[model samples]
Target: MADEEYISVEEVASIMGLSVRQASRYAAKVRTERINQRVLFHRDDVMEQARLKGIEHEARERAATYQPKPTKTDLVPAGEMLEYIRERDRQLAEVQAQLNQALLEIGRLQGQLTDHQQIRQQLTDIQSERDELKQAMERARPWWRRILGHD
Candidate 1:
């Protein structure tokens, strides 16, 4: 086959409006290149296949009038995008402030709990000391003798 006569499977598929597999099947000859390891098919065979399938005219018509869909990045202006970013930053700052306040409240509650625990331990110790003193006094003298100040 002549060098100018052969076309890649991808180009054949695009021109004939068919998948690469379908184009490969329809093409007359599949050529393999050793240098780049590329596959190519005959252009005339692809065109003949499209004509036989009665889609050649339709494919050309579609290709002539095709328009790509617009994307968000293309439609949005730069100033509005900047404003959206600023609004997001403001919301983030507000959330951060709330988190800090919650942390401070947790610390204060923990300190109060520690203080209450210490007071409870001191009360327990005082009760035990009072009981010991009462036992000593009772062992030394009877109740009536203690009331009369006699040992």
Candidate 2:
């Protein structure tokens, strides 16, 4: 056993693998002492509480070993990752080409629409001129031809 001196709440929590507040809650169920203007719990009392909770050995074993988790770059192979990137780039290029082709088609359709509208306006003007020429020709025919519905 260690000395019978009072231990800090932080130290007890560290040994028991608990947060300070949680350890304080458990420490309240055991013996504690005030030292140097601070409340302190006994090491034996906290350790006894931890043992009763069945986590004392687990905390000690975790503190003994050190192993890091594997990262993404460590889990995947470099050659396979490069092939995936190439496939993604090829798909992106295909989509971009389709978009450019669609834009060009839209421009061509817009030009045809403009030409169609101009042709419609020209046809309207020609119809109005033909009606005027027919009226003038009828007036020159001395109004008798118009009554007969002829030129």
Candidate 3:
């Protein structure tokens, strides 16, 4: 409450509705003009100064509402975060390579399947031609001659 009392820079700023820099400036002025050295302000003098600046009541009201955002660095431990990112990248690269290889193998299998289908069609055609030739030979043979041909 007196000039000799010590208050933190943040406390002075909240009391004055000023930024820390502004509060510090006022503190400096008080030191030069009234107090001989840097020290806490008397409660009465701080109120009077706040009144003169038109921020005394407003500062006190806003002080309770102020909420600082948590810094990004604080949310995650630095070492663990770095390791997690590196591991994720490595896994992604490995998965990509495996996907590429799988696609290549699929293409190769498809080609072999096509070749096998063509071969099957050709074998079916050849069997049909052979059956037709055998039928024609049977029709051309005379029954008596066919019966005596073996002897």
Report, for every candidate in turn, its global Cα lDDT versus the true structure: 0.73, 0.76, 0.71
Model 2 Cα shift for residue 39 (angstroms): 25
Q: Write the per-residue lDDT of candidate 3 for residues 1-151, one digit (tens) a residue.
A: 3433545455667767678777777664453233355445444456567778787677656545655456688888999999999999999999999999999999999999999999999999999999999988977888887888842
> 137 in model 1: Cα distance from truth in Å?
3.6
For lDDT, the strongest prediction is 2
lDDT (Cα, tens digit) per residue for candidate 1, span 64-127: 5545446678888899999999999999999999999999999999999999999999999999
- Cα RMSD, each candidate: 7.4, 9.5, 10.9
Q: Indicate the worst ten consecutive residues by lDDT in candidate 1.
A: 26-35
Candidate 1 regions with alpha-carbon error over 4 angstroms: 1-65, 141-151
For model 2, residues 49-85, the per-residue Cα lDDT tens digits are 7789898787656434424446678987999999999
Best of the candidates, TM-score: 1
Return the lDDT, model 1, position 49.
63
Q: Candidate 2, TM-score vs. the true structure? A: 0.48
Return the number of clashes found in candidate 3: 1
Query: How accurate locally is residue 106 in candidate 1, as Cα lDDT from 0 to 100?
Result: 99
* C-alpha TM-scores of all predictions: 0.52, 0.48, 0.48
Give the runs in model 3 whose Cα sits over 4 Å from its true position: 1-75, 145-151
